[model samples]
Target: MTGNQASAGHLLRLIRTGEATTRGELQEATGLSRSTVGHRLDQLFRAEWLRDRAGISTGGRPSTRLEFDAAHAVVLAAALETRHARLAVFDLAGTVLAERTEPLLLEDGPDKVLVRLAEWFGPLLAEAGTAPGKVCGIGLSVPGPVDWEAGQVVQPPIMPGWDRYPVRRRMREAYAEHVGPVSSDPLPVLLDNDANLMAYAEQRAGFRDCGAFLLVKVSTGIGAGVVVGGEIYRGIDGGAGDIGHIRLPDRTDALCKCGSFGCLAAVASGRALAGQLSALGIPAASGSGVREHLAAGRPEAVRLAREAGRRVGEVLATVVTLLNPGVLMIAGDLAGAPFLTGVRELLYQRAMPRTTANLQVVTSSLGERAGLTGAAAMVVEHLYAPDRADARLAALESVSREPHLSPGPR
Candidate 1:
């Protein structure tokens, strides 16, 4: 973040983050001469990453105001849940142009799932009035812990048969097979945990200024995602927020999908609640079913949900105390009044007064769409990051000279 005005990428980042906007501001921010600043900005303009405001009067002539141009490319983002998938085409600015939700069973395995995803992108792009060549990257949100460098899930309880899969390669191959090649080099595919994406989306939307933010998703399974200093806190090996597997006292009889007993998810996850409700003859099948019951004012569902919240809250007390996040967002299926009330009741009582005093516990604002937003943001951030953007600019220049680059899909 220092003043290395030599990097055109650094200048672009300054413009994107609003640290600098005009030639003079760029010079002042980066401590570079006006000529050097203009030279760097010229690179950004040539790469189509920046634009100039033509008629802005700054106390005299029309001032040169720089802006990051987000209309030059598009991104494809998808969120995969246990029983459904949501995919969308977004411009670089995070605008959802075309989106669809369909039943996509995760148990179908990665090969089938990734191919189906690749096959869907072409139509989604056409619907958004874009071609495959216009896509800068793809982002995927999965309901499990992710090995980001390997670009695959790691022993996810909900997502079986996907451990150590070469997701990035398989996804690109599927796209080339179904949609055909769009460029000389392979397109970038980014993947992350669903709860992490949700937390990221929530943080970016409303709590970007908050230094510490926590989002707990209580759906078919329970999980937590933390955003610290405006970044996802994926602990070493990306297992930082797997709170569901946390063991609890005396709940050994309750079995978890992770093949363990006395875990938090085993006691309080949506799957666990659904099982309890089914045993009580209520016929609740999944988290969504429990949500439907809650919406219909089923007292039993309400009671169970509240109790589940309390149990989750019990675990979260330690988390909140440890992280001391400014915002604690409750998301996913069980994020309504009963569950939230239960969480608040227990969380506030156990955590220290200082921790609870500054914490703002709230429900989701973006709901299920949060995953899509997060995925898109992840792609945008990764592709547009300073170092990567510079590399991409170099590639663009190299691509321009290559006569064999494909123009579009079949």
Candidate 2:
């Protein structure tokens, strides 16, 4: 890559990530010469793509920190849940614009959903006044196993018949049809497990200081996102940190969608809770209903949530023993309220005190937006590759007359 490419890539990452970095810091981070960093900053400032604010004085000299101009560019992020889909427009500064959620009619499957998504983009971008060309790319979070390398959803147990779905291909094609495409620069698409995205959001956005952590989703199904050294660990085949299919020692009767009988998801997932509640004559068509019942102090709902939490915690205790993460961040519909409380109680009680001593389990701060935000983060990270960043920077400069803005991701 050219020096221009190196500068553009480094600057994009600095902006996209919302890092409050100074030129000296950027030079150190990018391993570039002071002159190179200064030259790029000048070019970006001349293009109105970057803005700097005076930062706190250091012991030697006060520094000015750089930030991306939100008005200069935007990213659109989407995530597919079992019951609905979420969409958000995010400025380069990580501000969310026009967040919208719509019900998922799974009966119609991928085609209908993809079309609806494509339709929504035009109106949404118009509302945000963001030109289609200004959008770096879109990131997606799917509710199943994903071949991140191939950008495909592969053999999703919960999303039946969606096996080997070319989600990235269809989405990029549909979006390009509506928005027009670059001759040789097709819009990039990235895919990751939805729960893993949530974990990424939690660890990077809300809990960045926590060097290692586990973010667990106890929603329609159970899944986990594991972060070590501040990076997501996708194992071989991109299935790392997927704890849903781990067998539970006590399960015997429940059958899983994967044709298993004893998985943690089979025993303690939101679907499992709904079934357990339904068997007890409670109304729980949705996990939200179960949460409402718990909030209303319904004893039965409380009892069931607590029991499920305990079961989940028991399964997690083994993982805790193995991973020894610094903290456990729980998300999803049932992860808070009565569910996570019970989990914390049970995990501490069951796991070795030494293991529990340093571990602090908490609810996710990003909540429902975590998945979408992480999707945006994914695109920002991938697009900032040194090979592509210079072209993207040039595109941004040519697309808008504004000064080059610092690109940062939230």
lDDT of 1: 0.88
In candidate 1, what are the lDDT values of residues 189-304, reduced to their tens digit?
Answer: 99999999999999999999999999999999989999999999999899989999999987899889999999999988888889999999999777888899999999999999
Instruction: Write candidate 2's Cα lDDT for 125-193 as tens digits.
Output: 888776777776788888788888888777777886677777777887888877654222566778899
Highest lDDT scorer: 1
Candidate 2 residues lying further than 4 Å off, grouped into runs, are: 1-8, 11-35, 42-49, 52-65, 179-184, 385-387, 390-410
RMSD of each: 2.0, 4.7
